[model samples]
Target: MTTNTTPPIPMDALRTLPTPELGMLLLERLGKETRFLPQNITAEARIAFKGESDEADLLDRVCEAWAWVESKALVSQVGTKTSDFRRVTTDGRKLVADPSALVRLAAADRLAGPMHPALEGHVRTNFHLGQYEIACFAAMKEVEVAVRDTAGLGHSEIGVNLMRTAFKPHNNGAGGGPLADAGAEGGEQVAMAALFAGAIGVFKNPTSHRTVTFDDPMEAAEVIQLADLLLRLVEKAKVREIKTENE
Candidate 1:
């Protein structure tokens, strides 16, 4: 006589769950194995979900859910003689230890989808990992770099001064910076400078000097979005500068 083994979680129930939920379940399974081959995990998942749905379709869903886990950096492909093996990362272990973080991460990703390409790297990664202050700082720092590059300023000019010098208006026989909008009213130009300076001062500078608390993820996401807006403004300024030079 053969005895059947029961799946820890019913495969039928798992099928109805969302990507993050499915990903979490897969992540927990990965944690149990410690190290595994992607194909092997998917094959096992297929067996567990055997009668629940079409075999190919079930395999595709499991692979996609596992892919989500990889995308989020939960599991890393081990670098050994072969590339077929993967191990759960430290972050993945933490998530398995406290699944609440994965829920928070999913919510944050939904709120901050398709972030500016400039911010999609470090800023998004840190934000998803619950490092809110670091994410905010990195976003604002990208804004600072955009301003500096657009204005042709060297590395020595930085922080609020970089923003001021970059956006300083034409006034009192003084010429404006390359990024400054000469066509705009003098007051508007000055306000533009103030905008960049204030953003750097409030969001970026504090993180550099000391530890700043950002307990609320929603507020942190908004701050990163603000940085995205500032980067767009800098891009516009670059185009304006080029147009001014051409004319």
Candidate 2:
């Protein structure tokens, strides 16, 4: 008997692609082998595993999913690499030889279930966004922490005493004028200016109003910007996945 065994790969599970990428892998590897069509795999059965299932059976399903992936052209292998002189093997003229197409093919192979492509793409984009959010949060907290650690030091860079003071809107009668008069900047900036001015005026009168009434981190412009980027990336990937599914 010849020493040949095509290691079973999840070549069929990737049925969402056209004949070029995902399907191409399965077409090349399991060309002659009989395979099951995706139509035959019941949706309820596939979903049932998502709920209640034994661990071993889940693994079997994963393997079955892989086998299906192989069939669907999701994932493919490089074939055996035996170094023996007579045992050597090579692809025949029947297979597609183009190298560039394999990248999408390889991507299709690695993903699972619906939105696989989009999910994978989102994973990349979201990962970077997540890292950026973490960095910003760190920077914001560092200032607060710095103010606490340097209790006595008079450092202008990190405002410890300024943070301790109260800043609130002013509704009292004053020559300075109302909050939304002829010249108004922003609600927050206006609130800040009023609050500081009021604090100075009410310095001797401590029973006037509450101090520092601003929403914590109310202006997450940077975080919001990052979130917007991630949302668009996910939405775009989702649309692509939807298209791929129908294909």
Candidate 3:
């Protein structure tokens, strides 16, 4: 008789694993089996996870992980019938062959949400290429260009100074900068200037003078999203300038 010698995976560890990780675990198992029913997979996971207590919870998590794999198109039904049997997809096999692909997949998933039209290509390409710092730099560069173009400032006016000058509040009966909201209170306008100036000073300036590092892709995505918001603000400022000119 053949001996079954596979070691049981600890349930404690499986409980804490992220959905994607759990999905990958299931995918790995499916890759070995070639085809499997969802319930059988869940049973197998329960046994492999050593889930004697809270079996229902373990089964639910396994099912959820399986669903995530299916949602990602990593697995496909084996036939035309409404059957639970599924086989790993070509992409799934590729992912299994190269574990690093999971990192790229996660990065792509993080950036899958809606972004500013300006950043959709530039930031994402750099981010996907693992150029996190360059991704952030490219995003903030867009903000700087939008600010300069909206305020009609020359390229010589750059960085924090450019942001301050472009968004400077009205004072002493003098008109505010082109991007500044003239109708707003001086304090509010000053706050806007400080907001833009601070963002440029912190996020944009260092990337220009030195090599900045961004090890965390999620953090880099947040920086890009911030740039997206600034771009929208610049567009609003441009619209306000046009309206003011018409008036």
Candidate 4:
């Protein structure tokens, strides 16, 4: 005789459930039993999700989701291992009151502080929805705007040219501005200019001029963090105002 094991959760539905939402769901069930186990949560989820979903399909997903919440400190564990667990944590309770709190907390951790206040809304909202490419695009756009506003450039100047003007090392005809001053040496200035310029040219420009799709949140988050770093550099950049004889 053969015994069948529970199958994995459906990837489609699992992906649809963001981590915070998953945590919230677990909190609802685990509330009934103050002290719980993975199997208990799994059984509860299977029953709740039945008819709407396959019973065998929910076990692994519920377990995986709960483990993540526990690891994140949103849920605490009791006895030794997965066999015994605890309910919602202080952090988890905060999320229950305000679902969006998880996104803010995550953004803070991912960014090591508040992301540029300007960029936070876009990053948090779309990121939770799995819209990684849009989040990255919006972030780079903030960098572009910051560079433009700092440089006193017009709308006509964009992409590579804008970055080149704002940060390129001072030369005979054209003098580099704030970004140039931010760098230690002339070469470093040029490189710094190129870094932001390249980021905008390669990432921002494409997204602005067309649609770009990114499937992996990790990859998109990397780019968003890069944009964050660039924005931070801009924030620290020293603007040198050149005064002519007229002034």
Q: lDDT scores for all predictions?
A: 0.82, 0.34, 0.81, 0.69
User: Could you tell me how far off, in angstroms, the CA of residue 163 lies in candidate 4 after the best superposition?
Assistant: 0.5
The alpha-carbon RMSD values of the candidates against the true structure, listed in the order shown, are 6.3, 20.1, 4.5, 10.7
- The CA lDDT at 131 in model 2 is 36
Q: Report the Cα lDDT for residue 166, model 1.
A: 91
Please identify model 1 stretches exceeding 4 Å from their true place: 1-111
Q: Looking at candidate 2, what is the lDDT of residue 49?
A: 43
Ranking by lDDT: 1, 3, 4, 2
Show where candidate 4 strays beyond 4 Å: 1-69, 73-113, 172-174, 238-247
Q: What are the runs in model 3 whose C-alpha is more than 4 Å off?
A: 1-9, 14-21, 27-40, 46-53, 72-108
What's the count of clashing pairs in each model shown?
Answer: 0, 17, 0, 0
Models ranked on TM-score: 3, 1, 4, 2
**Local accuracy of candidate 2 as per-residue lDDT tens digits, 124-199:** 3432333323333333333333323322334452332333322222234332222122123447535544443333
**Residue 101, model 1: Cα distance from true site in angstroms:** 7.0
User: What is candidate 3's lDDT per residue for 1-247, written digit by digit as tens?
Assistant: 2124242223564679987888887787678876777667655665654535666676677777878888888988887657767888888998888777787677667678888888988788889788988989999999999999999999999999999999989996797788999888899999999988988898889999999888776678778888988999999999999998899
Model 4's TM-score against the true structure: 0.57
Candidate 2 residue-pair clash tally: 17
Q: What is the lDDT of residue 21 in candidate 1?
A: 82
Q: 1-247, model 4: which lDDT tens digit per residue?
A: 1123332233355657865566556665555455655566566556555654444445566777777777777667764556556666666776667666655556545654567676777776787666777888888888988888877788887888889888878765465665566326667877888898899988889988788987655667678888888888877773234432135
lDDT of 1 by residue, 1-247 (tens): 1126344334664568777787888888789875788777755655665665465666666777787899988999886737678998988998899987765665576555676789998888898778998899999989998888888899999999999999889886679877888888889999999999999999999999999999877788888989988999999998888887899
Give the lDDT of residue 59 in candidate 2: 34
Ten-residue region with minimum lDDT total, candidate 2: 84-93
TM of each candidate vs. truth: 0.58, 0.17, 0.76, 0.57
